[model samples]
Each structure stands twice: as C-alpha cells, then as structure tokens.
Target chain A: MPKLWNETIEEHRRAVRDTVLETTAELVAEQGLRGVTMSRIAERSGIGRATLYKYFPDVESIMAAWHERQIAGHLDELADLRGRSDTPGARLAAVLERYAFIQQQRHGHGAELSALLHRGGHAAHAEQHLRHFVRGLLAEGVQAGEVRDDVTPDELTGYCLHALAGAGELPSKAAVRRLVAVTLTGLRPQG
Target chain B: MPKLWNETIEEHRRAVRDTVLETTAELVAEQGLRGVTMSRIAERSGIGRATLYKYFPDVESIMAAWHERQIAGHLDELADLRGRSDTPGARLAAVLERYAFIQQQRHGHGAELSALLHRGGHAAHAEQHLRHFVRGLLAEGVQAGEVRDDVTPDELTGYCLHALAGAGELPSKAAVRRLVAVTLTGLRPQG
Candidate 1:
C-alpha cells in the first residue's frame, strides 16, 4: 500500500478503537456492568460487529481497556500538576487535594461499578504510581522543613493515601477539602 | 406447659441458634458465601432443616444476625476499654490501638467476606457508635489540652478514623502503632 493510504488506515483504526471504548463505558454507566454485551456495544458505537471484534474480544476486555485509559489520563494530569508547581509543599497539597477530589467523584460511579473497575493489573499499577508520586513529594517537603522529618516518606505516603481514602465516602467537595486539610496537619513539623 | 420443660426448651433453642450462626460463618470461611445453603447449614449445625427455618428466614438473614452480634460484641469491648482509668489521651491511644488490631484481624476475613459483612443496618449503627465514641474522646482530649482545639471534634474524629484505617493494610503491629502516632500528632496543638 502507499504511505498515505497506510497512515490513513492506521488513523481510522485508532478512532474506531477509541469510539468502541467510549461507547462501552457509556453503556456501562447507563445500564451497569452486567448489562453490556458486544452486540449492544457495536450497535451503540456505530461500528460493525466484525470490526468491534477486531478491536476487543469481549465486554470485559473493552471495560479493562477503558479503565486503563482512565488511569493513564489521571496520571498524566497529576504529572502536569507536579510540573507546574515549584514548592514541594504546594505541589504535595495540590496533588493531595486533586486526589481527594478524584476519590470524591469516584463515589458517583457506585460501588458495583467501582468493584468492577478497581481490580486486576491496571489498578495495581495505578496504586504503585500514586504511591511513588506522593513519596517523592513528601521527601521534598521534609527537606524543605514543611513536612515532618521524623517519619520516613514511605510511611507518610501510606498515611496520606489511607486517610484520603475516606474522601470517597464524604458528602461534599467541602468535606473532602476539610479531610485533606486535616491530613496535611498530620504531616506538619512537630515543635 | 410445665416450667421445667419450658425452660429446657428455651435453653435448647438458644443453643441451636448459636450453633447455626457459628456453622454458617465456618462454612463461609472454608468455601465462599455462595457455597452455603440452608441444607448445608442445617447439616453442619446438627439440626433438621425444619428447626433451622425457625431461627432464620434465609442465609442472608442469618449472615445479617451474625454481623449484628459481631458489632455488638465490639462495642461492648470498646466500652470496657473506655471505662478504664487513664488520661483522655491515654484512653484514646488504647482505643485506637485496639481498633487497629481489630482491623488487622479483619484481614483474615478476606475482601469478599468483608463486602458481605459490611452491608445493612448493623454496619451503619456500628459506624455511628464508633464516631460518637471517638468524638467524645476527642472532646475530652481537647479539654485536657492534649488534642488541638482548632479543629472540631467531629473533624478530628474523621481524621483519626481515616488515618488509622491504614492499619488494616499495614504489614505489622508496629506499623499500625506508628500510623496511629502520626494521626495523633495531627490532633496535637501547634507550637
């Protein structure tokens, strides 16, 4: 095939793959994980059944890919926040607050949906990346004298993640903010 | 009926009910929740199916009752700890440590069992009771000048629960103690 023709085919394939993943997520959101099927996804995505199969083997695979994409997007956003901020404490606070907000929004997905999304390799990788991100920020904060030097960064990272996990159960954005503030207090230097 | 006969019947009924609950939990531990059935429970408890029906409507009801009993037992234990002679901070530390241990022990139950056990009215009631217990302790700590007065007792209670929740995932008892200490530091007055 000509170079232009090859590039066009690849771009078309990528667009179709993205559409299928998005359509699967929308269907799941509307009807739940159990209600989704390949035929339904293909019909909703405006793709042929054969073409859909070329992209994903089944609904589970499609959901897994969509979840992976979501985690990647979140990591990219966090990295963007890290790059924009100068002070370690400010960067840590920004990341923590954003993370708490993400957790709060996650509540709207419902427990069944969350259970479906929070399993397997992608979830584990996302967790490891999150811990590493927070640990690096804590190490910088300790050196800056803003966060406590007494505890190891790894321990502090665990404390932050565990405490912030409660944000998902909180009632409002304001409550999440208050939770983050309280968490930050625990990391402050002792007299 | 004669008084002696009636008392003996009542005693037998209590014994049978306790046996049924214990058998159900044991079966769930050995095989997952779906593996349990009325016949299995009756067989394991050494009771006939008809007699088992008199105690619980179904497996769901039996599990709910078992969870309720567990919560009540936990509350009684916590109340006992609260009654011991100590400063407010000391009482809080003892309670937090015990709670952390309980969370750690809960790990033996596994996530699927946890999901089954954490639903319904009993879990909500236990949560409310726990919050009230912690909030009361925080109020006492603030009055004693051991806990910070800047944040409301309710907020501190939330912070304590959130931070200490990490205990469930900690690798050892020492790590749980360290996490609790970090949480307490947040509740201390700023220098």
Candidate 2:
C-alpha cells in the first residue's frame, strides 16, 4: 500500500486532515460551537493558517467535512445491526447504546458535529446517505415483523431525532428505546 | 371588566408585557433573531424604547418572557394528559403534534429563541424554562408506561435535542410526525 507514491501522498494528506479535524473537534467540544474558526482551528492544529486554508476554503467547510467523517463512523458502527436476529426492539436498543455514546460525545468527539449543525449547512451527500441508511434499516425491521410495517423508516428516523432532541423533553437512550417499542407495537395499524 | 381594570393594574402590566413579547415574536418570526433588538421591538410595538426597556432590559428578558408564556400554554395543553387515562402512546402522539408546530416556529420564532439559548444572564431563564418543560413532560411519560422508566428525563431531553439538531434528513411536518412517533414508541420499556 505504501509502495505507490500517489497513494503515499494521499495518505499524508488524509493524516493532516484528520489531525486538523481532531483538533477542531476538541476545541468545539470543550468551548462550544461559537469558538470555532479557521484561524483557531489552524492554530490549534499546529499548522500554518495558509497551509490549513489550502485544505479547507473556510471554517464551514472544515466543519462540514468533520461532520461527514463522524456520520460515516456512526453509520459504519450500525451497519451490521440490520442483519442482527434481535427483534426491532433489541436492534433499536443496541443502536441507541451506540448513539448515546455519540451523543455524549457532544462534550468532546461530538463538539464539531454539534457546532456544524448549529452553524447550519446541509450538504447533499450527507443528507442522502443518512436518509438511505435509515430507510434500509426500517425496511428490514418491517420485513421481520419486529417493527411496524405501516410507517416509513424516514418518519421513524425523524421522530427519533426530534424526540431525542426532546421536542417536549430531553431524550435518554432508554427514552428512545421505549418510544421505539410503542411505535413498533402500539402505533402499528390494526387489521 | 372596567371595574376589574381599576383594581388590577398588575394584570394590565402583564398584558402589556405579553403584547411587547408578541411584537418581538412577530418581528422575529418574520425577520430573524438578529432582527430583534430593543429598538426594533419598541418601534414595532409603537411603545417608546424607554417603555420597552422599562419592561424588558434586553432581548434576553423578552425571550424569557416569551418562552415562559409559551410554557404556560404547553402546561395547560398537556395538563390533562398528565396522569390521564390515555395510553402513554396516545399522550406521546399528542406531545409530538404540538412540537411539530414548535419546530415550524423556528423559521421565525426560533431566531429569538436561538439568541436567548446561546446567551446567558436573563436569557438563562428561557433555557431553564425550556429544559423544565421538557423534563416535566418526560416525567409524565415515564409514569405512563410509554417512556422507559429507568432513565432520567434530563438525559433523555438532552440527547433528543442533540439528535434532532443532528438529523439532516427531515424537512417538513408530516415527516416530523412520523419521526416523532418512531421515537416515542422506541422509548417504551422492553416488557
């Protein structure tokens, strides 16, 4: 893998990008979203501002890229849950356990994500990938009779997000799971 | 009513306070959180700046008052649901329906709310009240057997907010309702 010069060059670039994102992530998490900026990120990353700008045009792009990275990680972790033999209930619990850690990351690993979301950029790839991944999961649950067949996965995913956001209250992992249970069992239409 | 007015000047001040808040709410709803400042509010309400300042020292105060007023409304609406004979599932549906509207308020109502949440001081009231309203509801749901009884309402509410803000897929109310249903059901206990 290291023998190819182009591949080696690409690896170095990726390493630099990861370092910059990791530093920015920590700053955002520790200080909250408002403190993040290209200058600050570059300074923290130990790279010159010019060098950093070459990689990222602006602070928003940096945040956007960081968010995509985090989402990718989350998706990868949940990838196998779709095939798990557990009922939809168990599957959701397992997913929430994973998500809860991600959520807890707000004070650290999640800082950049939270900042980016608040900053408000809707990149197309991230949006489509998230929707498609969730849609696939709900479809699996329905086929298994572990989750209700009537409602679409998109709806389910949205509700989980808002409820987790605590539209009415803050949501815990347990709260998320219980809500899923009622949804899979209670909200399903009767024949 | 005329006779009552002579004895209830306090009520009149409260009424005026609400009108001032409504003015800010309307403007912010139309413009954005940035659009709301002492001067804009005073001019829009046709109340002098001094008078507006007399009621609310800054945008934060105005926001807190607005949120508190809304909290009063939410409590009133959900009061009957609390400990009522309705299934936890039904009660959660009721809550999400209300939240769908709350989110819509963001296109306008959210700017000021955002301003308030991000800042501290009198703005702290809004955040506190907002959190309180959410936790109170989760507590109710926990008792209803619709939400998992094991978790704290605060953790649930916090995670939900982070998730709602993170979910990049949702755009409309119909979508929000479906997502909310999925989330609420997920929170139900495993048994």
Candidate 3:
C-alpha cells in the first residue's frame, strides 16, 4: 500500500476505537455497568458488532480503556495546572483543588461503578503515578520553605491524598475548597 | 412467672443469640459472605434451625446485629480513651489514635462485608454519633487553644475522620499511628 493510504487507514482505525469507547462509557453512565454489552456498544457507536470486536473483545475491555483515558486526561490536566502556577505553593494548591473537584465529580457515579473501575492493575499504576506527581510538588514546596519539613515528602503526599479523599463525600464545591484548605494547612510549618 | 425465673430465661436467650452472631461471623470470615447460610450458622452455633430463626430471621439480620454491636463497642472504646487523658490535646490524640487503629483493624474484614455493613439506618446513626463524639473533643481542644479555631469543629471532625480513614490501607500499626499524627497536625493552629 502507498504511505498516504496506510496513514489514512491507521487514523480511521483510531477514530473507530475512540467511538466505541465513548459509546460504552455513555451506556454505562446512563444504565450502569451491568446493563452494558458488546452489541449495545456496537449499535450505539454505529458500528458493526464484528468491527467493535476487532477493537475490543467485550464491554469490560472498552470500559477499562475509557477509564484509562480518563485517568490520563486528569493527570495531564493536573500537570498543566502545575506548570501554569508561579510558585511551588501556588502550584500545589491549584493541583489539590482540581484533584478534589475530580473526586467530587466521581462521587456522582455510584459506588458499584467506582468500586469496579478502581480495582486491578491499571488503577494501581495510575495511583502510583499520581503519588509520584504529587510527591514532586511537595518536595518543591519544602525546598522553598513553604511546606513543613518535619515529615518526609512521601508521608506528606500520602497525608494530602488521604485527607482530600473526603472531598468525594462533601456536599458542595465550597466544601471541597474548604477541605483543600485544611489539607494545605497541615503542610504548613508548625509554630 | 416469678421474676427470678423470667430473668434466667432472658439471660439464656441472650447467650444463644450471641453464640449465633459469633458463629456467623467466623463462618463468613473463613468462607466469605456468599458461602454463609442460616443452616451453617445454626449448626456452627450448636442450635436448631428453628431456634436460630426465632432470634434472627436470616443471615443478613444476624450480620447486621453483629455489626451494630461492633460499632457500639468501638464508640465506647473511643469515649473511654478520651476520658483517660488529662489534657484536651492529649485526649484528642488518644481518641484519634484509637479511631485510626479501629479503622486499620476493619481493613482485614474484606470489602464486601464492609460495604454491606456500612449502609442503611444503623450505620448512619452510628456515624452521626461518632461525628458528635469527635466534634466535642475538637471543641475542647479549640477552647484550650490546642487546636486551630479558624475552622469550625464540625469541619475539623470531618477532616480528621476522613484523613484517618486512609489508615485502613496502611501496612502496619506504626503507619496507622503516623497517619493519626499527621491528621492531628492538621488541626493545630496555623503559624
């Protein structure tokens, strides 16, 4: 095949895969994970069942792919926020606020879905990446004398993440912000 | 009936019920929740199926009763810890440490059992009581100027509970203690 033809085919395949993932996510969100199936995803995506199978063997794989994509996007957004901020303290604050809001959004998805998606290898890898990302920010803040150095950066990272996890249960965005503030306060130097 | 005779019968009933709940918990722990049935529980408790049914209609009710007892015991333990310490700061620390260790102990119970037991009216009521208890300790800490007063006691209560929740995933008792320490640090007055 010609080079242009090969590139076009690859692009088309990528587009189809994206469509299937998006359709499966919508079905799961509307009707829940138990209600989704391969055929339903295929039909919703306007693709043949055979074509959907070529991209993903079943609904579970499609959902996993969708979750992976979502996690990556969130990490990228946090990284972007970090880059845009002027100081280490400001950067950490922005990233933590965004993370809390993300958690709050996830609270609406129901426990079953959250439980299913948060298990297994992919979620673990994402969590490790997140810890590393936050730990770096904390180290930066500590070097600048903003964050407390009494505790290890690693421990502080764990503290911040666990503390902010409560944001998922908070009733409003303002509550989420307050949670972030309290969490940030924990990192400040003691009197 | 005579009062002595009535008291003896009530005591017997309570003993039988306790045996049934303990047996069910052991069975569930060894074989997972799905493998447990009323028949197995009755056999393990050395009681007839009819007798068991008179006390608890099914396995779920027995489990709920067991969970309620456990929550009540934990709350009582925390209150006792609070009363033993001399200073407001020491009292808060002791209660928080005990609460974190309690959470860590629950980490061994498996997610299915935890989820099933944490829902519905009884769990909600227990949670409310826990919040009130912790909030009172925090208020005392604030009055003594040991805790930050910038945030409301209610907010600090939520923050402490949520932060210590991460103790459930810690690898050791030491880690649980460290998590509790970080959580307590978060409540200290700002520099």
Interface RMSD of each: 1.3, 5.5, 1.4
After superposition on all C-alphas, the RMSD of every candidate to the true structure, in Å, is 3.3, 5.8, 3.0
Candidate 1 predicts chain B with a TM-score of 0.91
RMSD of 2: 5.8
Q: Considering TM-score, where higher is better, how would the candidates rank from best to worst? A: 3, 1, 2
Model 2: per-residue lDDT, tens digit, A57-172?
A: 97667767777787777778776664573676566656644554454444343434554555544445654665676666666667766667666766665544434333223234
The 10-residue segment of model 1 chain A with minimum total lDDT is A111-120
* Alpha-carbon DockQ of candidate 2: 0.32
Model 2 reproduced share of reference interface contacts: 0.53
- Candidate 2 C-alpha error for residue A104, in Å: 3.3
lDDT of 3 by residue, B1-191 (tens): 55798899999999998898899989998999999999999888999999888899888888999999999999999998988999999999999999989988898899889888987589999999999999999999999999999888988888999888888888888877877777887888865
Candidate 2 per-residue C-alpha lDDT over B25-106 given as tens digits, one digit per residue, 9 for 90 to 100: 7877787777678899989888889888888888767876786677567556655554563665565557545554555544
Tell me candidate 3's TM-score on chain B: 0.97
User: Model 1, B16-130: lDDT tens per residue?
Assistant: 8888889998998888889999999999998899989989999988888888888888878877998894899989888887887777777787887788788787898899999
Ten-residue segment with the worst summed lDDT in candidate 2 chain A? A162-171
Clashes of 2: 34
User: How does candidate 3 score on lDDT?
Assistant: 0.89
lDDT of 3 at B55: 94
